[model samples]
Target: MEKRTLGTAGPRVAPIGLGCMGMSWGYAESRRDDDTSIQVIRRALDAGVDLLDTAAVYGDGHNEHLVGRAIAGRRDEAVIATKGGLVVDDLATKQMHRDGRPETLRRQVEDSLTRLGIDRIDLYYLHRVDPAVPVEERLGRPRRPRY
Candidate 1:
């Protein structure tokens, strides 16, 4: 598999990143399988795929929990990436809203950490930009967030 650096000073990883969305959420609900998803993630790692993508809105956090389980033993081998900033108001209808305020982002990070069963996240993405908050204001002190 081809490999490349994620950034100027980031870890080297496989060119392909697995998006672990439909595995626990989206599309066919009758096909969600925890065991198989976990197996596939491990297999991907064994096959040189290190980046795994998931989001908080996916199944209202179910996807992250699944990812947490999948990388429990092999956490060192997987670079997990999850998104926040999108609040789910209606799980059944999949209604969501953007909330990029620092406070909201902090809370979301905490929830993500707990659900993912990890101390720190490799990459945290803002699911979307909130119209109410300025992007610069939201990211003024990106590294100074308490949560």
Candidate 2:
């Protein structure tokens, strides 16, 4: 497959990526199936679509959990990109709020790592910039912490 990247220094990835949001949550809650979702993620990787896009508020971390299960043995083959700064307030209504404080980001990074079941995330996106927080504090240099 042809390869591209998010930026000059980002990891090389395929042009197409699979969004794992609808798999576990969102519009069709009744049709949600973990097994099928896992199969889809694996097939995407096998097909060279390494960019698996997910987010923390997508089903309130349900999407991350699904990705964690799908990439259990083949994490190296996938480029996982997940977003933070957004928290799900109501699943049914899909209401979300942004918290971009550095302290909140610190906790978010720890939580996302735990939910994704990985040591490092290929890309960590800020879902939304919290208006109450300073931009420098929320989107400054990558905060490297002991994992």
Per-prediction count of colliding residue pairs?
Answer: 0, 0
Candidate 2 positional error at 51, Å:
0.5
Model 2: residue 143 alpha-carbon error in angstroms: 5.8
Angstrom error of the Cα, residue 17, model 2: value is: 0.9
User: Model 1 segments beyond 4 Å from truth?
Assistant: 144-147
Q: Which 10 consecutive positions of candidate 1 have the poorest summed lDDT?
A: 138-147
Please give, for residues 46-109, the per-residue lDDT of candidate 2 as tens digits.
Answer: 9999999998888888889999999999988998888889877898898888889888787888
lDDT (Cα, tens digit) per residue for candidate 1, span 90-134: 988889899989888888889989998998888887889888999
What global local distance difference test value does model 2 have? Answer: 0.86
How much does candidate 1 score in TM-score?
A: 0.92
As a TM-score, model 2 comes out at 0.92
lDDT of each: 0.87, 0.86
